[model samples]
Target: MAETDFDLGVVTAPSGVLVLGMASWIDHWSQLGQPLSERASAVASIGGGHVQDWMCELVAVPAADDKALMVRAGTTTSPFDGGPTIAVLEIDLGLPWAGTAGNEPIILGDLPVDRCGMVLGDAVALDSWTGDSHPSTDGLADVTYWGGYAEAAHLQYGGELIPQHGSHVRGWLDLPPDDAEKIVDALKAWEGDQQGRGVMVAVDEHTDFHRFNRASWTHPLRIGAIEVAGCPVLGINWDNGDHSMRHRGERRFGQVYPVTLQPSPEGQTMMRWTIPPHAPVCDGPD
Candidate 1:
C-alpha cells in the first residue's frame, strides 16, 4: 500500500504523563481518605478527560543517551458497581511510521507489580524526581509495580485498593467475537488517522468473583479504537514485570462493557511534557 496516512490527530500528547496526572488526582483523593469513586462526577469537571502527551530522551548507560521510544496515552476514571473504575492509559509505541518520521515517544519506565501495593501518594512521590535526582532505572521499577497492582485492583473491584479492608473483586471483559473484530477495525481507522500509528489497550481481571481477594490477567486485547475501558492488567513495558497475566479463556468467553466518558470543564485540560533541553540520549541509533 502507498505510504499510509498515520494521522492520530496531531498526537496531542503522551498518555503516560496524562495517566500519571490522573493517577495523581486519585493520589490526592486517596490521601484525603475520600470515598475514591471512579464516577463521572469525580473527573467530569476536569477537561472531560485530559488526553496527555509525554516524551523523554533515554541515555545509553548513565550520563547522556539517545532516543529510545516515543509514546502517547489517555485515560479517565469513574465509579462502578459499588466502587471506582478507570478507562484510561491507552498506549502506542514502536510504530515504523513514527520512527521514520523522527517522532519517537519514550515509554515511561516500568512500574513493578510489588511496588504497586503501596499507597498512590508513595508512588507519585517516587515518580516525581527526574533522572538528575534518582537513577532512571529505579524510577521505572517503582511505576511498574504501581501499574501492576493498580491495574489488578481496578479490574478486580473497580477501585484502587479493594475497599481498604474488604476483599477485591475484578471483572474480566470478554467482548463478543464480532465486537472484537469491530474494535480491531476501529483501531485500524485510528491508525490510519494517526499517520499509520498502531495502538494497544490492556485490561486487568479479578482472580475470583466469589473470593474477591486476588486478581490475575483475564485478557489483554490489542484492539483498534480511540479508547478502551477497564484496568490495564499488562503494562506497555512488560519486560520489567510491571504487568499481570490474563487467564487462558477469558478473552474468548468473558463479558464486555462500554466505558462511560465524563464531561470536562472548559478551563480544565490534561498535562503535557516536552523533551527536556538536555536529553542524554537523542539522535542515537537504538
Candidate 2:
C-alpha cells in the first residue's frame, strides 16, 4: 500500500477515541472461539484504551494479498453516546479492498510485531462499545446499550424521541435470498472497482412509508459493502439500522418480489424495490 494519503479529521473526543474495523475481520477472530474476556485482555495488553498525540498507532496484520490490518485515523459518533462525534482508529481488515490494483500490500511502518496487540485491543473495544456481548467479559458487558437504535430512531424520527401519538410502521422490501446475496456481492465488487462510486438503495417512490406523525420521506440509504457482525442481513441500511417505513394511511403494500441492481444517472449503484405488506409495525402511544 504505497502510502496513500488519507484525510485525518480533527480529534474532538480524545478520551472517547475508539477502534473499529470491517465485520469480516471481527468474524475471523470470533470464529476462532476465543473467550470474550481473553479477547478483551489481549486488546488491553496492546494499548486499547491508551492514547497518544491524539492518535493511536498499532501494528498491521495481513489479512490477504492486497490488504493488511492497519489503523487509519478517522472520526465517528461514539457508540457510548450519540452526540459529540469522536475520533476513531479504524482497522482495515482488507475485505472489499479499499485500495486500487497493483499496489504493494498496505503495511504499517517500523512497528514491532508486539504492537499488534493494539489491533486486537481495538477490535475488542469495538465489540465492547457496541455491547454485542458475544463473549460478555467483565467490564465489557453493556458498555453501550443499543446506541445505534437511538441514532436510527433519531435519524428517522427527526427528534430525540419517537412522537407519542402516531402510527409507526417500518416497511421492508423482501428480496429473495439469492438476489440479496448477489446485490451485496455486487456492491462489494463495486467498492473494489476503480471506477466504482458510492452506492445506495433507492426506496421506490411509489412505495408507501411513514416514520411517525409525518410523511417521513428519506434520502437514499447508503450501501456499505462491509458486513456488520451484529446484523448479517443484506437489507437496506442494515448496518445503520435505518429501514424504510410509511404512514399507515399511505400503505399500499405489495408482495415479496425480486429486485435488480441498476446504475443511476449520477453514476451510483442502486436497487429499487416495493415495500412488502408484511412489515413490522409499531403504533405510537395513544
Candidate 3:
C-alpha cells in the first residue's frame, strides 16, 4: 500500500519528547466518525446494510521515555450505537513492529480490572474522572486524585454521586479521597507490565452490543494518560481481537457510525488527573 505523509503535532515532557511524523492515515476513528456514516448510508440506499469494520493498520510509536514500549491510544464509537470508546490510538512512539521481522504490530496495554477506569476530557475540563480505587504498589506512570467528593465529582465514573446534590442514589457509595501519587504510580505499573511482558489490548470479548466495558480480570483493564486531537483521555486499548466482541463480520475494525471528537481550534490544553480502578491479583494476558 502507498503511504502519504503528514505531521500531526509534537509533545514534550521531562521523560522525553515524541514526534508524530507518520506519513499515512491508517483506517482510524476519525474516518470512522465521518466517512463510515457516509458510506453506510450510501450502502443502505442501495438496500445493502452490510459494511466492513475498519482495520487497525498497525503503526508503532516511541513512548515519552523514548522506549517505544508504552503506547498512547485514541477513541471511537460503534456505528449503530454511539457509545464512548477509544476509536484508535495515534501513538507517537517511533514506528517499529514488535516481531523480529518488524512486521507484527504492537498490541494495546491491558490494565488489570482492579486498577483502571475510563477518563474523557476536552482542552480544559475532563468530562469524566470518577473516583475509582487503583492502589499503586510503587510510584510510576500515574494520574492524580483528590481526598474529597468535591474533587471526585469531577470524575463521572464508577460511583453514583448525584449530580450537584452531593449525595448518592441509594446503593451507590460516596466518592472517597485518595493520594494524588496513586494516579501516576498506577500508570507506571501498567506501563511496566507492558515492558516486562508485551503490550495487549485489555477489552473483553462481548459479541452482542456496544456496552460500557466492565472491570475485571477476564475483560480488558483500562489505564494510561494520553492526548488525542488535543483532548486528554484514559481508557482500554484494542487489537484485531476486538472484532469478535464487536460482532462485525463485514471485516475486523472497519465499521463506523457517527461521533464528534473535534480538537479545540484554539489548540491543545491539559486537563485534571483521575484515579482509575486497580488491577486484579489474577492474571491472563499481560
Candidate 4:
C-alpha cells in the first residue's frame, strides 16, 4: 500500500509562505511539473499552501538500508538530500499524508499520489477531465452540487432525498442554456435599477469534505458526491417529466427566464439567481 507519513517541520520563513523541513523549494501547485531541486524557485510564481508550497515530490527508499529507509542517506550516497536528517519528509509525501495514493484508488501506479491528477496511482482524480474544474487546478467550489438542482428548502441536511448522496453535496453544475448572456445581463441590471427584492432561494448544505492529502498532489481538493436523481427541478434547466411530481406553479415547462437582480431605491442590496416555483427534481425517494 502507498504510505503518506511525512515528518517535515512546516513553517513560514517570511511573508505568508508556508515552509516545511527547511526546504527552500516552495511546493507551489503550478510547480507540480518541475523537478524537486528547482521547485522552490517556482514558489514566487505559484501560491502557497499548508506546508507553504502547494506542490512537492515523493520518492521511495533508495537502498532499503536503515539510513536510506529513514532518508538518512545524503545526496552523495542516496537519491535524496540532507541525508537521513532530511529524509523525514517521507512523512508528508507518502502513507496517510498529503501526497500519497491513500485517497485515490491505488490500483494504478507510476504517477504521484494527488487529487489534481493522480491519487497515489497514475489514474487521474475524479473530475479532473471535466471542463467545469479550475483551469490549471481542476478543483471545484469547496462546497456545492449541480449548481442549482435542489429546491431552496432542500439545501440543508434532512430535507428530502439528500441521503442518496450519502453526505453533503458539491461539484455538479446545471447551467442555463444561455449561461453567458443571462449572467451578464443580470449583473448589469443589478447595477442599473434599484427596487424591491424578488425572491430568495437556499439549498441545504450537506457537505463531506476530504482533506487533500494524496496523489494528484496539488492542494486540498475533493471529488465530492454527485446527486443523480435527487436534485431540484427548474423549468429553465429541466423538463416537466424530469420532476417527481406535477410542477405547475409559476415556472412552467420550456420557460427560459433567469433570476433577476436589482438594487432597491430604498438603499438596499437585492440579489437572486433563480426562477419561480423551483421545486424538487426528484421529489420522491431514491
Candidate 5:
C-alpha cells in the first residue's frame, strides 16, 4: 500500500504508531503478498462474566531498507460491546519506510498521536520488541491480592461474596488461624495514629489484612449483603466517585483469578471471579 493510502497515526508513545482501519485490512494486506505470522493468542474475561478470545499477528511490511513489524489484533469470538472491530498495528521506529523523494521517514514528532488502540497481549509485547519499557506485572499481583480478599470475605460473611469494586476496596480477608495471627502482628507493626495509613498484609503472595482504611477524601466503605440469581453475596453501598469535583478517578476490577501457577482448562493463569449482578447503587461517600 502507498504511504498516502495508509490510515495511520502515532500513539501516545513516541516510538509507538497505530494503523487504524477495519478488521478486513489484515486479509487485504495478506492478499497483497505481505508476510503474516501468528504472534500470540489467549482468552480473557473482560467483565460481567463475559469472555473473549484475543489473537495477535505479526505482519511484515516491506520498507526501503528493512521490514517493519506491524502487530495486528482482533477478537475471534466477537467484538467488545458497543465497540467496532478494529485492527491496531505497531511499527518499529528504527525501520525506514518508503517515502517520496526528498521526504524524510515518518518520525514520532512529525505525526498527530492517536490514543485509540485495541489492547491485546501482543500489543504489549510490541513495546518489548521496540525496546520500550515493558508493561508491569503489578496488575497481576493486584489481582492475586483481590482473589485472596474475596475468599476471605466469603469465609467471614458465610455467603458467596463477590468483589463489589476494584482494588480500592479495603477490608480484612479471613485467613487461616496461623496466617491470621501473622497478619495481626503485621498490622500492629504497620498501623499508626495517622488517620488514613494504608495497612496491608501479604500472606504467601496473597492479601490477608487485619485492618483496611480509606483515604480521607474518599467515602467510607459500607458493607451490604445481597442476592444474585438466588446466591447471596456481599455488596457495596457508596458513591460512584462523582460527588466531588476532585473525585475524578477510574475504577477497574479483575473478574478472573489464577487457578494455579501453570496453565489449565479453567484458565491459562487466571480463573474467573464473580461479578455483581447489577451496578452498585450508592449515595455519596460522606
Candidate 6:
C-alpha cells in the first residue's frame, strides 16, 4: 500500500514553468524524450477525466528522508538567481480512456512525495487551482470545474483523481504555517465578502490573436483561497487568461505567481503575504 502523507507542501508556478521550478539534475519528462509531450501523446479531451500515455519521475528532495521518495525537479532560465527547492511528481496521463493496463491508473509510488507536491494527497488543505478571474468569483470563470473539483477532492479526502492535472492547478505550500494560514484566511475572507457577485468568467482581452502576456491586459485574479509561500518572502502575482497567447499554446490553461498586493485595491481585496520564518512551511495551508 502507498503510505499517505497529506501533510506535505506545494509550490506552484506558471504552467510549462513548473518543470522549470523543480531543481532536478536530469530534467527529462519521460525515458523516451526531454519534453513530456514528445513521448506522451493523445492528451485527454476536455471534459473527460481520463488521460493517456502518462509517466512521471522524482527529481529532487529537500530532506534526506524524503529523498527516497521524491521526484526531483529543476529550472533552466527562471528569474530567480539559484535553482530553488522544488518537489516534482510528473505523470504522463495517456489518451482519454485508453483502457490499458498502466495507462489508466494514477500512482504516487513512482516518484517524489515529501517536500513539494504533497497537496496531491490533501484535499481540504490544498488550495484549489483557480485561473485568473474576478475576485468575486469563487473559481476561475473559464475553468468551471475548479470549485467543483476542489470540493470533490476535499470531500473524497485522498484519491487518484485529486491530483491528475498535467499542469492546470498548482498549489504552493512552502512557507511557514502562519504564512500559509494567511493565504487561507485571505481566500476565505474574499469568498465570504463576495458570494453572489455577477463576475465575468474567462473573458479574453486580446482580439488580435497575436499579443502575448495577456496578464498585461488586466483582468481579475479571483480569490477563493490564498496560497502562501515557503521559500522566502510572501507575494502574489496578478493575472487573467489571455486567449491570444493561450488559444494554441502551452498557456492554453492560465497562470499564477507571487505578487505584492496593492493597498486597498479595487474589486479584489489587497492582501499582503505576511508570515514569519520560524514556523513549518511544508504542511497544508492553515
RMSD of each: 22.5, 23.0, 20.5, 25.1, 20.5, 22.4
Residue-level lDDT of model 6, residues 181-243, one tens digit each, is 444444333331234322111222211110112211221211011232211101111111221
Q: Which parts of model 3 have CA positions greater than 4 angstroms off?
A: 1-76, 94-234, 237-286
* Of 1 and 2, the candidate ranking higher by TM-score: 2
Q: Which structure is stronger by lDDT: 2 or 4?
A: 2
Kindly indicate the candidate among 4 and 6 with the higher TM-score: 4
Q: Give the TM-score of candidate 3.
A: 0.22
Q: What is candidate 1's CA lDDT for residue 120?
A: 15
lDDT of 4: 0.22
Of the candidates numbered 5 and 6, which has the greater lDDT value?
5
**TM-scores for candidates 1 onward, in order:** 0.19, 0.20, 0.22, 0.20, 0.19, 0.17
Best by TM-score: 3
- Give candidate 6's whole-model lDDT: 0.22
User: How do the residues 204-259 of candidate 3 rate in per-residue lDDT, one tens digit apiece?
Assistant: 12211111122111222233344433333333423323333442332123332221
The alpha-carbon deviation from the true structure for residue 147 of candidate 4, after best TM-score superposition, in angstroms, is: 14
* Candidate 2 lDDT over residue span 204-265, tens digit each: 21111111001122211111111223211111111121112211222123322222222333
The candidate with the higher TM-score, 1 or 3, is 3
Candidate 1 structure quality by residue, lDDT tens digits, 92-204: 22122211133323222321111122111111122222212223221111100123234533343342222212333222233344444444444334432234543333222
For model 5, how does the per-residue alpha-carbon lDDT over 1-286 read when each residue is reduced to its tens digit? 1111122221221212222111212223233442121111111111001111222222111111222332212211111221211211233323332333444222211111111111211222222221012232221112112332444433433332224333333333444546545544544354233553433433322211101111111212222222212222222222333211111221112221111111123221211111112233478789
**Distance from true position, residue 271, model 1, in Å?**
15
